[model samples]
Target: GDRVLATAILDRVLHHAITINIRGHSYRLKEKLKAGLVRLEETATTT
Candidate 1:
């Protein structure tokens, strides 16, 4: 359930970015960085 929801949200955001060209957007950049950090933390904790 969680993976499916995350995948859906990621896909939607990617589609929106491609269609609306959300490059150089501070909000999106911050969000991406935050998500990356979260993934890194998760991986670190797992290993």
Candidate 2:
């Protein structure tokens, strides 16, 4: 997308909207972690 057009579209859509900034990993990764399929570097090192 053109930067100018993208900015215009974003400006229009967000004119009356409230935005939230979410932090950290996504739910899918969390699920994988809980299921013992995904591990953080520290966890993998320990095990």
How far off is residue 21 in model 1, in Å? Answer: 17
Candidate 2: count the clashes.
Answer: 0
- Predictions: Cα RMSD each: 9.6, 6.3
Model 2 scores worst on lDDT over the 10 consecutive residues at 38-47
Candidate 2 residue lDDT tens string, 1-47:
69999999999999999999997777877788889886876455544
- Best-fitting candidate, scored by lDDT: 2
CA lDDT of each candidate?
A: 0.64, 0.81
- 1-47: candidate 1 lDDT, tens digit per residue: 99999999999878857456544436654576677744544444443
Model 2 spans with C-alpha error above 4 angstroms: 32-47
**How many residue pairs clash (N, CA or C atoms closer than 3 angstroms) in each of the candidate models, in the order given?**
0, 0
lDDT of 1 at 25: 37
| Cα displacement (Å) at residue 45, model 1 | 12
